[model samples]
Target: MTLLLAGVTLVSAFGSSFQYGYNVSVINSPAVFMQEFYNETYFDRNGIPMESSFQKLLWSLTVSMFPLGGFFGSLMVGPLVNKCGRKGTLLINNIFSIVPAILMGTSKVAKTFEVIILSRIIVGICAGLSSNVVPMYLGEMSPKNLRGAVGVVPQLFITIGILIAQILGLSNILGNLEGWPVLLGLTGIPAVVELLLLPFFPESPRYLLIQKGNEEQARQALKRLRGWDDVDDEIKEMCREDQSEKLDGRLSVFNLCTFQALRWQLISIIVMMMGQQLSGVNAIFYYTDEIFKSAGVNENNVQYVTVGIGAVNVFMTCVAVFIIESLGRRLLLLAGFGICCVSCAVLTMALNLQATVSWMQYLSIACVIAYIIGHAIGASPIPFVMITEMFLQSSRPAAFMVGGSVHWLSNFTVGLVFLYMVEGLGAYCFLVFCAICLVTFIYIFIIVPETKGKTFMEINQSMAKRNKVEIQMDKEKLNDFQTAAETPKKKEEAHSTSVL
Candidate 1:
């Protein structure tokens, strides 16, 4: 069972989640060069240099299109994953990557920037689908005890992908003018590998057993994946969910929103997803090049620093994979956000000091590095794993839909307005992110329940108990205050004094 789970996670991470990070960081190193091409192409086609703002707008479109495409791709996940199953959606998603790769590879030859933008959108869709599907598939396949660790594998690979893209985008490698297209085009390679290998893995046993009601096939798959024949306990748990889910046919986000039984589970998913993305993780990634420049790093060596930061991210996420189960999801989520909150404050201070102090550039660099480390360990991976843990088979896909949409949309929001925010808010741009992180930490500390070594039923019951306790405490406090107020004026004053 361990070997099988490890093997499946390894392949899925490389094929799917890897592409998400690749798409994200790939455009960074080649930015100036791509803009040059956009200029050259504009001059060739229109016989004049492109206007500066228009050129920036075009570059922004190229860079921002990935997240926009991600938004659309997120919207597609519910229908695709529901209709085709997790594995099938992944297989079909490769088409988006391959076709876009061809278009991007041929962009220079064709001398058209439109093709490259289109490819970005298509590749974005591919990444969006992969990002959502991989986690859910891993979650469904994981055994209860190893679920947290297994769920984090995709995020770990994503950091690896970012590191790889950074290395590939180096000037000596693929970051130069001639090498840019090939860099963009190679995004398809992982997809092709995934397409070939996906068939060798079994369908998600939970999907087959609960969604399809195929006891025999589910049993076989469970046996193959778990390396044991005794499956009564697993099946009984599925039966509990299946009986209710089947009658509902298929649950939608709309259904999840209104379902009283799942209120907190759904709230946890929403708040976690929102906190993860809105905490400014994506903004940090988008802003890295500028952060490096502001820190007075040379332009030539900036990519190296970027790559180094990515390496830290990968290293921290690897640590996260090993420790997530032990610390439990709630603690890590809180710790991750807490560290990031402080890092952001430090970042804001460093940015503010860069003008007054010669060494503050280094402080800014240190702050950004610290922020990335904080995020890689907790904010990046935990919510992704937790979202999968929050819901059952019936509502999992819908939950992912809501979660993925919030994630990509928040990413899109950051990518879209990041430059303007930096221009307008300057160093204080990060203060906003700092505030978001602080509020998110307090909210999670108060509302999100711990889910370590717990079953779904147990988690649900515990949440209910916690909420009830809070409510009763609130009522008791209110009654005590009222009694003090209702006492005779002089006697009430004496009573209040005594209570104080």
Candidate 2:
């Protein structure tokens, strides 16, 4: 973590992840305004009023576009990161935000509600690409010893971004009808900032040496990134290790899909990422106002409470960044998911009892806060960091693709069905989440290795016992090949002796 490294990491986080948090919550405060705009457009087009159900459907589509865009964005991660390089892909990703921001900012004047939907889709793509790329870039750039803390940087900014969005959503700022578009358009600012600043930062050294075969440039980049001239050992280390494991080219998502060797690592990341999203964090954010209302907070003060929870999320993640390397990934994930499991159960009971027991409402609110804390401490940040350490440069993007797709898919599932779950099972919807948390925790506690300070290969080899045997087999084959090649020289010397 040199200053330049820290600065670029922050720049990436702000440009990409900040937009993600912003988009996720920016719609919340102005839900009414946007919905009204939707209805007005429909009425103007049809020359008649729209049905409530239909209006709701349109509004749902509008809100849903962000995650949907993210889904599509996830699918593109492998190819984009592979072809464009992490830094280059992210630079191009600004188009998704800047254009959408304009559309969203001027949606009122354009008199086309469709542009708003379009804006959501574009900005959603922005969030999606950023979410996947920033983590991988930061993780690749970070030194192994400081990797965990530095890797968590994007997530820390994400929490801060969410907090900032929540604060900005207040009516006194940008949540008002006239102000909503401005709020929605604000996502573009980070993109512009990132675009301008990112060119100055060096490309990932791993990408340069391992992927591009530009060893000299890789060495230069590493020196700049590490703030030292003597990066020779570092370059040589990666080159030597990768010489055996290098693929013909960057692996495709399709190849990753079929690759047998990486199956378990792939599964581990898929589960961890899915677990991160499905651990009920977003559902908690969605349920906050009702929870606060149930706890006797007035409607106006609900925003304040939501902001407080956002603050808690930011604060806890900040704490996590400091403690991640020391505590190690496994313990933190277990603690985080374990705390969330209990918190979700408590939340279910509290919600169910709120009608019968007056104090139960307050208890539910406390549970909500506890759950957010639990999520931030472990579940929120570790999965992203773990993805980086889990795969080498060749397979990292594909791993991210799988992870990102699962993440957004799970998140989208929650958004689409959470209300129905609440209606069908009431507070017990958390029971489903509680079950998810418990099973995920058990699997991770038992299976996932502590990737705290290990190199990519060390973590991979330790993850599955079978992988060690496979690697050893490869080494043996290489040794045999070298021996066979040397046998010719021995025969040539023997023939010379016979001639003599």
Candidate 3:
């Protein structure tokens, strides 16, 4: 049964990853193609000669729009997952993927930019929904012993999609103006397969028990997940946790705002996401062609180099999956951030020396590649897994929504502003990112806790205990109250209430 659950989870995850790759790779291969097509077809038809500035702006828009759609789409997933259940929400999202592929593929054959961009927005929405729901679902469904490992699947599949996109982008067979549409359209295939396959997977047991209040179904789901013939004891334990009044109000956004534990968890998630974005990894992935060109690589060979970036991303993420359970999250994060800081410093130096020697360009490429490798090993997987771990059953979905929103918002910002930064700030851009990485390393060291082998409730209780101690210490500082508390009757009442 464990194997079955893992299999189903992997398949569902793969569909989402495939869509991710398609969106990322479409731009990598077709960047030059689009520029040429715009000049020859769109611009010529409008009797306007292409300006480099306008072309760059259009290219930026084409890349940034997906993240914009993602921002809105991620916001929608919280309510939908709460209402429809994970399986149902995913099923609907799969349809979102399929429709855009058909429209974009057919429209591109007819040479319609309007159709292509429209399709991209729709696909972006689908990707956002998957990104929000898949990690939450995987985290909730797995056993505590395997949660971190299972949660890493989404990140793994994301890198896998990057690899697939990189390979597809590099393929000479599909490296043309028309091939861009076909490549973009091919993202729908996994969605189609998922729509056909995912119905058999069980609903998340935690969601079933906590949100739906269906104990019997939750038990059946847990039994299947655990491969146990009898799960009465486990069900009772789950019920005991559910009965605690502490869990009831935690899911409310109002409670999240007021409660110390929830507040800290939310802050941690936001910080982790912001760190991920500010690391400049997405900028590297989305604008690999531009980065390579700036390194003095020939314009025609940029897509192939972009493929190399993707390959490193995919390979390093695989390394992360193996080490995550053994070496642990904190170590990986520290090592990854340290490496990124060094790489960014080197990249800045390489850019400063670009006029002196051609070899500096090669050095810049190496630094960027090293930065990507570090990200794959640490920040990429850790933030996602940690966010999922930080909340209790009641608060997990809402926390995920908050974290995922920050993530996509940062992604949109990086994608939208990076081209402008490249043009205006030049090498100083790497310096800014390097500074952010330094701060992130410090934050992780001081605040983020070791979650290895801990259950959801255990982690929550540990955080709550920490909050309780701080609250007690703050209360003890009341001087006037302390004088009044010297009275035996008042002191007895206070002690009694505390004991109760």
Q: Which candidate number maximizes lDDT?
A: 2
Clashing residue pairs in candidate 2 are: none
lDDT of 3 by residue, 1-500 (tens): 27877777788788775576568656666678866765665664677777889777767667777877777777777678889998889898987889988887776456566666677778888888888788888887877667777777788788788778767766586657668667777888999888888888888877787678665578678878788856554554444445442335537555665776566677778888888887888665654565678777799787677767777887888788777888888889888888898888898888788769788878877888899989989988888888778786667667777777788899888876786887898877888889888888988888778787776756766666656633122233233233332442464445433211
TM-score of each: 0.90, 0.93, 0.86
> How many clashes (backbone atoms < 3 Å, residues ≥3 apart in a chain or on different chains) does model 2 have?
0
Q: After superposition, how far is residue 476 of candidate 1 from its true place, in Å?
A: 41
* Worst ten in a row by lDDT for model 3: 469-478
**Candidate 2: 10-residue stretch with minimal lDDT:** 491-500
lDDT (C-alpha, whole model) for all candidates: 0.81, 0.83, 0.74
Model 2 scores a C-alpha lDDT of 0.83
Clashes of each: 0, 0, 0
> Which portions of model 3 miss their true places by more than 4 Å?
35-58, 230-237, 245-247, 250-255, 286-302, 354-362, 469-500
Which 10 successive residues of model 1 have the least lDDT summed?
469-478
- Residues 165-251, model 1: lDDT tens digits: 999999999999899999999989999899998889988888887777565577677778888877656655555555434445578
Misplaced by over 4 Å in model 2 are 247-249, 464-468, 472-500
Order by TM-score, highest first:
2, 1, 3
Count residue pairs with overlapping backbones in model 3: 0
